[model samples]
Target: MLLTTVLIADFEKAGRATCQRLLQLEKKIKVVGEARCGLEAMTAAAKLKPRVLLLDPSGVEGEGVYLVSTILEKSPKTRIILLSERASDADILDALSQGALGYLAKPALASYLTKAVRAVAAGEAWVPRRMVGRLIDQLAPGQA
Candidate 1:
């Protein structure tokens, strides 16, 4: 029964709180840290070294990309999941391209979020159903 440590990063306090509350219901999921900004998120990831990072890039003044890149560069073991309102096909593909292991929409149900965290922690990619083909195309071309 190993618990999965998670860091919640969002622009709004309520966003962080909502995720924290929802995730706490799962015994195996622990909310280790919360961040209200990209800088805080990066610092928390470095210091806390949580197993999963649930990042919402919306409030980061477009630095979300850089934040993700640096966090991964600094903490390669921290698997990042983008939990954002930006749900366009391009956004999904871009996030995955930028090294996120999972992407969930803003209104995601608690079950989906928890399931995604577990799946990503277990080394699997998670994405909305519609984006699966795009994710595959994005990842596979590089392997060829």
Candidate 2:
């Protein structure tokens, strides 16, 4: 099986540890690098060019959404998955708007997180099921 490499950008020690532990259970996923800040994340992305980047932008230096765009600019092919405690609809929309392929609320189940990573690596978008309606509403207002 082809491995899906992942780079994690989370400042909290526990957050990174939790992600590492949960992702390790999946044989197809490999953790390539970890970054504690946005600059490190950008450098890692440019250097490693991992298939997926699991980022918690809240811990980064600049605005979360801006960081998303910056990272993509440097590593356009690297798929980003935003894992944040902020799950508000607006936050989810902003993340998606900024080019994140996946958005998962923090404390997400390992199954869901790994599934999201796999799906994003395969070039599919992953977001909370409830947000689908909101996204559709925004995309086609008053149509559906």
> In candidate 1, what are the lDDT values of residues 62-94, reduced to their tens digit?
656657778898788999999876667887677
Error of 1 at 125 (Å): 0.8
CA lDDT, every prediction?
0.85, 0.90
RMSD of each: 2.3, 1.3
RMSD of 1: 2.3
Model 2 Cα RMSD, 1 decimal: 1.3
In candidate 2, what are the lDDT values of residues 15-127, reduced to their tens digit? 88989999999899999999998899999999999999999989865677678898999999999999888767888898899999989888775658898999999999999
Tell me the TM-score of each prediction against the true structure: 0.91, 0.94
Model 2 scores worst on lDDT over the 10 consecutive residues at 104-113
